[model samples]
Target: MSKEMLNALDALEAEKGVSKEIVIEALEAALVSAYKRHYGQAQNVEVEFNQKKGDIHVYSVKEVTEEVMDSQLEVSLKDALLLNPAYEIGDKIRFEVTPKDFGRIAAQTAKQVILQRVREAERNIIYNEFSQYEKDIMQGIVERQDSRYIYVNLGKIEAVLSKQDQMPNEFYQPHDRIKVYVSRVENTSKGPQVFVSRSHPDLLRRLFEQEVPEVYDGTVEIVSIAREAGDRSKVAVRSNDPNVDPVGTCVGPKGSRVQAIVNELKGENMDIVEWDEDPAIFIANSLNPAEAVDVIFDLDNPKACTVVVPDYQLSLAIGKRGQNARLAAKLTGFKIDIKSETDMEEFYAKLEEGAYIDAADEVETLDEAVSESDLTADEYENVAIEAAEDEATAAEEVAEANEATADQTEE
Candidate 1:
């Protein structure tokens, strides 16, 4: 070690944040190993570094014993007393055994140790920097692409955009900048590994936070999101302040807020629906472009429901290949079975006619039961008329409630 090496340590502490004490400790250990390897000594040795003087020293240690069995590791009391009068059997002594030409070896060893520590320190700094960004979003430039991953440069570190995380509608090229969601950050043996995604549902959520002040400041709260990357997504939002309309706030003036997000996602469709406390109303809202006539819950399964829509809007409510219903189910955390108005009517008719059986009863349809009973044609006609009247009245009440809900939403 020299004065120049001490200056380098100060520079490393200031610039790279590596502690001088840590480097000195590592250097001492490396010097001890070097001395034993080069000098071929079997004696116990210790290495120490003088921080002020920047000097390295190697010493041979031996335990004082009554009788010295090994000349290399033990010093007899007679020999120990010659050096120190208070020497005891268990006392130990050190002799300066630093080789004259050891400075050259020390310099080489110090260089290797400092370089290794610097690399490790840099990795720690990068890992700490990126760990804060986990589950957040960041902008990065595309660096390169291989068969498995697309490397994105996120300032201090290169993040990996895997095949599954990449949006199907987007293409990556060198120098192209894109916003990505930080799905995970890992400290691996090689370095810090940052995993980002373009297709994550939260990516949409974060974009809203960035673009919409109401969403970021907690005025409009996004309750749930269901996304099919590169195609369409549904977001359920609610308002903390009664005056704030969650959907309109998220949509911004003239759809500017959501339109910006759509552009970022490469023209992906967005359906922002108002979140309601009532599961029936929420499920109906989740159907978006399609109007749900009525929502019927399953008595046996609390998490399941059937949504009835007008026969003309059945395809729209179900979306193309059931995408709308699927996303709605995901958003509301329910199993949604969509049925047309006619289908629901037929279902009700079957129920009234005893076509559907209870768990404790034998399965029998209307015709089967009627053949076994002494029911006249006029009695059957009366039953049919009563069922029709009941169905009509129930339908009217549901329609009135739905209309009131729609009027309130519009206001």
Candidate 2:
């Protein structure tokens, strides 16, 4: 390697984060192999890389041993002293064995080694760089696409956007810039693989965080998010500060803050609702625009609830195909069974009177009826015997009454 090559290394180090020291070490190793290959011998070898002069030197090493059993690998002290008086028995000596055409060989080796080193360094750098961005948001340009994946150019690296993670109705085109959620980063044999997503629920959360300062700073907290991708999404937010309106803060003046995010998501509908500590109220809030008349929890199963709305809101509460109710269920972590005023009138009337009747009670009554029915013959015989005994007692009483009447007439 020459000074020009060393300058390139320095520039590579600065630009690609590839350490010059690592490159130099790899170059030295490559040259060591080159020296042994050209020599066709296994003599102990050493390579020193001079950083200042940008020079590499190879040496054949021999130990100054008392007995020289292997002359190629060791030297006697008397022979070592002939070359240098300070030579010791255990000291090693170096003889410069650098080939005459070593520079040419090294030049080719350096080219290959530099390319390999830069590739590895770039991979490591990308891995370290993108790993920090996991679960975060990023904006990238759509570079290309295939049936299975779309490649997005993320400045230094291209991230894969799988078809599965894409928005349902969003159409992609070349050079279209879109915001994406960094779903994962992996270190593969080829390099670092970054997978981005447009359908993840966190994508909405991160978009809001980026647009709204209150959410990023913790004044407003995003309680939960449920997204249907390119169609509709619901975000439940709670304000730590009583003065801050979480939903209003996210909506911004004239609906600008949310609209910007909506535009980024290709006009996806967003419902930012205020989160309530009371799940009943929260579930009601989650079904926005369509007023919820009542929300009743299934105490037997805490994760389920039945929501009641006005007759007019039945279709609105359920959306075109239950999209609103589905997103509400996801956002509230409850199984929502939405009913209209006219739909389940009996159910609401029970709630209006402040009472609940278990359907299980009706089942128990039916069981009792089944047990009373189909009686045995022995049971019927016992009933007939009791009736005959009652009739005989009545006959005895009538005979005594007649006797009393006769005695009164004689007197």
Candidate 3:
């Protein structure tokens, strides 16, 4: 029995990651409590267990006195003398008060104590394990679902995916393993409470980290992520190293890396674009795949932008249900008013009809000579857009040449 108890402690220390000494100390305390409950609290009890002998010793301490007022707490000096001739009146005596049924009580108490300690140790282990992963990504299986939450088993503990944290129109099934962003790790009376999310922008960031080696190595950096989870996500990337192409590396050889991430996200579309410091250039990149003929910013109203696209590309720019336009608006923090060449011409014609009074002498009026051309206002705006792109290309080329020259000089 003693050997078994020692082995149990060893197992708990190894499995639950609790210290063996802690378990033993808890066992000693529990045994003391059990002895007092079973016998009496006034009796000074001591318990000793030997693994080799499989023996448990329980003794009650008493003070040796001339007269024994309480039999349980004091021993007569005559009786102490019979047990040990050296006994004096003031000497304390430890009488053998070993109870036969103590083995049964100890076994029950030990079981309870070990179980309680194991749970506490496991809770701590789970808390520490998930605490490090907070604000990061994790993968787990869908274990069960409650009224407004889904429980995911992430090896050591279960994480709660609340309804509000889930993407609208997304569903999970039993045994389905999915990627989740660990938003919060909280300690509770029950155990560690892990809040997970699938709709967060960071989920896209983590996916890029996993897919792109350059991102992990600090060669490629994800500047920003805007995600409408389960539908579309836009990521802006920058290259720290001149030799690396951030967008190309994230795309991978033959599009394998990005494809893998898309599969994980269950067919959510991703737009990986180069990050630019200039707001106009960044806004233009953010609205890619839809050719923006012009992106006119309102200086007085910073949140407003006038976007013109070719008549044919108008529907594509707006997307099905205006999703593309809406997403672009959200990403750029702009109230985008999209117009085709025909719509733009009609709008300017109305403006020309109204006599315009110049608020500032510096403000340039639309040249009637250029406006006479059937090409429309959008065509004129397209010229300005091209000029901006040309300047940006020239700047990038110069920067790259400088970096190349520096590298050559170093070599």
Best by lDDT: 1
Which of candidates 1 and 3 is the stronger one according to lDDT?
Answer: 1
Model 3 segments more than 4 A misplaced? 1-4, 40-100, 165-171, 300-305, 308-315, 333-411
Q: Where does the lowest 10-residue lDDT sum fall in candidate 3?
A: 355-364
RMSD of 3: 13.5
TM-score of each: 0.86, 0.74, 0.66
- Candidate that beats the other on lDDT, 2 or 3, i.e. the better one: 2
Tens-digit lDDT string for candidate 2 (315-364):
99999788999999899889999987676656435543332133334445
Please estimate how well model 2 matches the true structure, expressed as its whole-model Cα lDDT: 0.86
Q: Global lDDT of each model?
A: 0.90, 0.86, 0.80
Ranking by lDDT: 1, 2, 3
* Cα lDDT of model 3 by residue, 1-411, tens digit: 568777777777787788977776787778888999988677877776665655677778899999989988899989988999999998887766778788898898878888898888888988998999999999999999989889999988889999877877578898998889999999999989999998889888888888887898889998777678888887888899889888889999999999999888888898888887777676777777787766667788998888878899899888878888887776776788888978876765554333222211112323443456677679888854655565566556555655653453243
Which lDDT tens digits does candidate 1 get at residues 1-411? 778889999999999999999999998999999999999998999998888888988999999999999989999999999998999998889999999999999999999999999999999999999999999999999999999999999999999999999999999999999999999999999988999999999999899999999899999999999999999999999999999999999998999999999999999999999999899999999999999888878999999999888899999999998999999999999999999978866765665445223311332344456567788999876765655565566556656655664564343
lDDT of 3 at 348: 56
Models, CA RMSD each: 6.6, 13.9, 13.5
Q: What is the Å distance of residue 367 in model 3 from its true position?
A: 32
